[model samples]
Target: MTAIPSAMRVIDVPKPGGPDALTLAERPVPAFGDDDVLIRVAAAGLNRADVLQRRGAYPSPPGAPPNPGLEAAGTVAAAGRNVREFKVGDRVCALLQGGGYSEYVAVNVGQVLPIPGSLDFIEAASLPETYFTVWSNLYEFGRLQRGETLLVHGGSSGIGISAIQLAKALGSTVFTTVGTDDKASFCEQLGATRAINYKTQDFVAEIAALTANKGVNVVLDMVGGSYVARNLQVLATEGRLVMIATQGGAKGEIDVLRIMQQRLVVTGSTLRTRAVEFKREMKQRLLQHVWPLIADGTLRPVVDKVFDLADAPAAHAHMESSTHKGKIILKVGG
Candidate 1:
């Protein structure tokens, strides 16, 4: 093994505030436990969760670092005695609870996966948080199946793009909502059957028209609040509505009678707080099912832009602008 550095630089959230609150600091490299592996991070993926963490709306899980990153890709620096899946020098990407915004992070072995030969560090870094979340919610929880119809909100966002591609690749017809014409075009190019521009059209009406008034089988939602009732209205019988985030707002009103009448199922989840065992199971499923598609070029990660580690604040600002088409990344190391 190469000599590990005693200290490394990390982006820290000094307090709950805006993007400028993110600042750089030096800290000791994290140590791995019996089931953990220490990774020398090359790049980190940015997510809306990180924005919430920076603003104090989302808190890190117990034992996670104060830093706000949720996924990273890099080479393994060391492995704990009990870790057998990965060893030093292996290239891997990880789903992290926190601390990915640093030069090195200690991750549980089960939450890590080998980087596919076709993907570079930045692209691999973009996979874990979005892929895991999309798979867990869209298939595991939402129960999306082949020939089913799915409506995905935020078509140009990382999770949205992942959902669109995965659903299409799995033989489902997908409809999505985007903020602009460019984003709509991007979503269609990525295989969305239709991309509704939310600013110019009502998604519920669009879905109703597109599905010929029969409605869709599942709705993958990130914008909650006002969308809850509308989402409920656009579901077919026994349809599933899976909520991953409440980007619009947390509170919403829904019709219980309508839910009962339509036999609709409303469910949601957050990935970071899930148990290691659950993530391990997800990792296994991805390796068996999704990794092959990624490896063979049937599916690919869409990167809108990348920023240097020291420019994390700019990255956050760009994300908040909501203008980027896909995943935003931070290059942390070579």
Candidate 2:
């Protein structure tokens, strides 16, 4: 490796609103706690949260670097004193609370997962955030089961694709809603039982018809606006809706009567602000259960596009466009 520097190139929120707000700068390399590892980033995954962070809407967690990135694949360049699970030179990828859009980043050792031999850096970089989020919300929290029906919004998105594959592999009948015909086709290829074009089709009606009007057992919702009401309308008598984002708007008048009548459960979670122990547990569970599928090729990251580190703004622009399918990533090292 080149002589290590105290600082590295990073993209920042020079101000909010559009790709123009993202600017490249040399910033101090973050310090690692005894339990952390310093990774030489090979690829960084772009997420809606990154876009939200860039816009000043999703601020970095307290004390983290202002730089925006949520996940990365890399090699361990330095391991802190207490780190033992990995050593310098091990190939790894990590889920980050912030500061992933840099040449180097410090990550909790527990958050680092060994890159499966079957995956390249770009594919591995696309895994952490989306996979973890989907696993936690759809399976763990939502209690999705085999033989049940699942409805996913934004089906072409990283989370949506992952949920579809995971749910299918777990034996659930999955349905997805996409904005366009192209996205709808992509969702079907990922194993969605039926991919509905929300632009020209009514997802609720389609799902109801598909499921014989019995409704779906679970709904993985990211579009929040009026979707809150619609989600309840399509939910089975005793179903769950796991909301991960509010691309549709945060505040909306929900129908409490519908929720009660259907006995629906609605909940949301963001893993970034959770305690280290909670994240550690999630990492452990993922490695134990999800890693084998990734290694054996049953589950894989859906990477749509990659941009050079300097072109992070372009990557963010692609994510904001909402036209790209799967996770957008940044190639960090030369």
Candidate 3:
């Protein structure tokens, strides 16, 4: 095959606010190193992190790609000599640290996963970042178990949707908090046992009453701030609270006595800055356990909308509106 010229659309620095912050510019495409693969990105998913990165708030990791996207689905255009698991033309999606908002992106082989037969390019693109986050935070860190109750905040957000599906499939009683009635219904259709409208409902009291005051075994929160204190109120003894993002602000005081008395575990992780080895381990675990479920269609990406690559600004706007019920994608190669 002839080597295709590298191409990209750059989002200029210091995006102030709104979708306009994400703009497009032509640039040279990236090259792959040994053990990496050159991918022709078919689509990329819009993530909150991407929005934050565009605003100069979320700094790119050291040695991370200049682009802001965190996940994409594409075909292998060129495989490095050391790559053994994939070859040219294989459809795949990758969990990326950066650079996914492009025509093509080079990714380490370890970060790429075979696209499940059940998913198309756009759907596949939406899976990696959210799925990996949900799996890592809810189960690996939170230790959510079967028969236990789990509460997911932002039930309509990408991570929230993922948590709802995976938790339900794993036999946990799933509860989610959504900002709108439509979002609440969407979460229910996605297998959430209970969907509370956070705008009108008291999530803590709702969960407590719903669970007969036993409280939940796991709390997946991206909303921090005052949520830190309320989260403890809804957590059963030995429960875990996994904080992935602080959308509601970070700094706040929590009752230390509540944590100690409840024996609750509190921890969180950000995937972008993690070591390559850590990501590779997560990739392996997902492939071994979650891939099969995805293949069988029990696990699916709840795609709320798709936008043309050129309309990434609009997609970002939709995300900022907080109305989309699931993953928002940017379709390329149109």
**TM-score: which candidate is best?**
1
The candidate that wins on lDDT is: 1
Please, what are the lDDT tens digits per residue for candidate 2 over residues 1-334? 5566888899888788888788999988888889999999999999899888878899988987788998999899898999989988889999999888899999888889999757989999999998789889987899999899999999999999988988898899999999999998889998998999998999889988998899999999998989988998899998998898999999766789888887889898988888878878888988887888889989878888989988987888888888899989899984
For residues 1-334, what per-residue lDDT tens digits would candidate 3 score against the true structure? 6467756665544445667877777878787898998888899998999888877788778787876789999889898999999999899999998888888888899899999876899999998998888888887889888899999999988898888888898899999988889888888999999899988999989988998898999999999988988998899999898899999998656789999998988888888887778788888889887889888988887888999888888888888888788889998863
lDDT tens digits, residues 176-252, model 1? Answer: 99999999999999999999999999998999999999999999999999999999999999999999999889988
- Measured on C-alpha atoms, candidate 3 has an lDDT of 0.86
For candidate 3, list the clashing residue pairs, or say none.
Answer: 6-29, 7-29
TM-score of each: 0.99, 0.97, 0.97
Candidate 1 global TM-score: 0.99
Candidate 2 regions off by >4 Å? 1-3
Those runs of model 1 whose alpha carbons end farther than 4 Å from true positions after fitting are: none
lDDT for position 43 in model 2: 95
RMSD of 1: 0.7
Superposed Cα deviation of residue 86, candidate 2 (Å): 0.4
